[model samples]
Each structure stands twice: as structure tokens, then as C-alpha cells.
Target: MIETLTRIPVAHYSNLKARAGYSIKIDKTEIALFKVTNGEVYALENRSPHPKGGVLSEGLVSGNYVYCPVYDWKISLVDGTVQAPDEGKVQTYQVEIKENIIFIVL
Candidate 1:
């Protein structure tokens, strides 16, 4: 069966700074939203994938990757894959922007 996607409006594009992280919640899921310098937006699970989980929203954003603030594990915001030497993955959400409003697909 095909899964249905729901688009939920979360924040305004103008309110999100480039290369920064914004935290949001959908139901029980906590998401970290990142706006890259290139004007692309990505959404990932707020929690890191390391054994000792860190908050992805508090991580450093460089290019399309975020370094887990706690363990310094590099995670890809585009696909939520933990970088080499690290063995794990976070959850990623589809993001859409329309008329400056950011929507997360779930």
C-alpha cells in the first residue's frame, strides 16, 4: 500500500537564519530544522544517533552536515546518515517552502 504524506506548516522562512538550527515538534516527534547558507532547508530528528544521543538542533551546521554537540559525530542533514567512524543514522523529514512558510512532510 502507498503511504500518504501530510504537509504540516511549521515556521516562516524569514525567521530561520542561514546555517542555523530551529527546533519544532509534530505530535510526539521533535525535529530540527536547518537553513543552509545556500538557502536550502532540511529537517531531521532532533536527537542524534550516537550511543549517547545528543541534540541535533544544538549541533553545528557546516554545509549540509551537522556535528552532534555531545559527541561531535558528523551527521548529514540531507539524509540523516552519521559520518564515517560513526555508525548510526537519524530520521529525516521532507521539507517544502511556499510563500515563505515552511512545511514538513510526514
Candidate 2:
């Protein structure tokens, strides 16, 4: 079966500051949105991949990686991969900006 992707409008581009993390919920899924300094917006599962599970939205954003607040695991926002020395990965969603509105593809 083919899966259909939906574009869910979350927020405006101007509302998100550069190099900051914003949290949004779609149905039961919690997503963390990050607007990088380069004007790129990335979407990732709000939950950390660590066994303890930290909140990615509360994590610090440095470049394209987010440091898990609980375990300090550096997770790549681009592909949702946990950095080396850490194991596991989070779910990443595609993001698009149209007319200053941010939409997350799910």
C-alpha cells in the first residue's frame, strides 16, 4: 500500500528565531522544529532516542545537532541520527516554508 503524506501547517517562519527549537503536536506525535542560522527549518521527533528519553525541544541547538537535555546525546536534526558514541535515532519529518508559513510533511 502506498502511504499518503500530509502537509500540516505549524507556525510562521518569523515566529521561530534563528537557532531555536519549537515544539508542535500533530495528532499524538510531538515534533520539534528548529530554524537554523542558515534559514533552514528541520523537523524531528520531540523525544530523544536515549534509553532515558529526553525532550528534544528543551535540548540545546548547535549547528545541525541538538544536545539531549537529559543524557546530552547529540542528535542530528537533519536525519534524526544520534551522534557517534550514542545509539538509536529519532523520526525526522520533511518541512517546507510557503508564504512564511511552516508546514511539516507527515
Candidate 3:
């Protein structure tokens, strides 16, 4: 259910560095959007699941996971799932890019 995305526009797509995340502030929420691969875009909570650590925008992207810099915890960017062993999860959003603009669904 795309409840928050107002419109699907060509987002300002940029060539993100390897293992890095990007953020955009929308509706007062410091949202984090990630492009892990050339063909994949994943959006997750800007805040870490553990403690009050802020998942830096420039995070390491591995496959479908993003490693949190605060604690080195691996988080699944696709579904906000903890990698393994760790029992923590973060909020994830849906990313849709049309033409080039990214429309994130909350």
C-alpha cells in the first residue's frame, strides 16, 4: 500500500559511491534511501535499531544488506531484517523510481 508517496516522478538519481547510503528529508522525517546496486534501490530507517545510533548515510552496502557503522550490525535493506544472530530490525520503506526520480512510499 503506497500510502505516503504523493507522486511518482523521476528522482534525482546520482551515481552513489560503493557501499554508501543517501538521505532525503521528507515530511519532517529524516529518511534514508539506499541504492545498493546499479539496479536496486532500498530505503530503510535512518536510525539504527540498536540504541540511538544514527545509521550514517554513507554505509556499506553488501548484496541486500547494509552494515550499520555504529555497531557493525548487518541489516537487510529489502525487509528491515537483521542479518543473523542479532535480534533487531529497522523500518523499511518502498522505493520506486520512474524515469530517474525516486518516489519513496512510507
Candidate 4:
């Protein structure tokens, strides 16, 4: 089966800085956008799976992982999987880049 996705333009590439994350709201859902040090962009649900806080956008990003600020749970930005020694996961969104504009699929 083929999956169809709605693409929503979020931001420009220049607006996102390396090692920084931006919080974007799509309808009623909150999404976290990250531009890793290597210029890779990722989109994930803005909530941490640890149930402590919804500050994944402000979490510390290391490589492809973001460490939750409340409990220090490391989450993979690529797949939204909780790192080893922890369990739980966040939702990841597909990202598209066109003409330096960033879009997230819902």
C-alpha cells in the first residue's frame, strides 16, 4: 500500500541554525524541528516520552539524539526511539526540502 502525506511548509533553511531546534505547531499538534550539526533537518513530536515535560525542542541535541531536559532520556531524532536503558518513543515526521524551504508531512 502507498501512503499519502500532506506537506506543510514550516520554515526556511536559513532560519534554522545548526545544533538548534524550533517548535512549530501544526493544527493542534506540536512538532519539534531540529537542524543537526551536519545540516540535517529532523522533525519529531515535541513531547518527551518520559512523561515529565514537553520540552523536547529545548532539549540538548547530540548527533542524532536529544536528551530530555526533565529526565535526561536520550531520544533519537531520526526515528524517535528512546535510547538504551530506557523505553518509549515519540512520533517522527517526514521532512522535505525544496528551494531551501522546509516542509513537514503530517
List CA RMSD, all candidates.
Answer: 0.9, 1.1, 2.8, 1.3
Which candidate gets the maximum lDDT versus the true structure?
Answer: 1
Q: After superposition, how far is residue 68 of candidate 4 from its true place, in Å?
A: 0.7
Better of 3 and 4 by lDDT: 4
For model 4, the stretches where C-alpha displacement exceeds 4 angstroms are 1-3
Best by TM-score: 1
Whole-model lDDT, model 1: 0.94
TM-score per model over all chains: 0.96, 0.95, 0.81, 0.93
Q: Compared to the true structure, candidate 3 yields what TM-score?
A: 0.81
Whole-structure CA lDDT of model 3: 0.72
Scored by CA lDDT, what does every candidate get? Answer: 0.94, 0.93, 0.72, 0.91
Clashing pairs in 2: none
lDDT of 1 by residue, 1-106 (tens): 9999999999999999998899999999999999999999999999988777899999899999999999999999889998898789999999999999999988
Clash number by candidate, in order: 0, 0, 4, 0
State the displacement of the C-alpha of residue 44, model 4, in Å, after optimal TM-score superposition.
0.4
lDDT at 101 for candidate 4? 95
Candidate 4 colliding pairs:
none
lDDT of 1 at 15: 98
lDDT of 1 at 66: 96
CA RMSD (A), model 3: 2.8
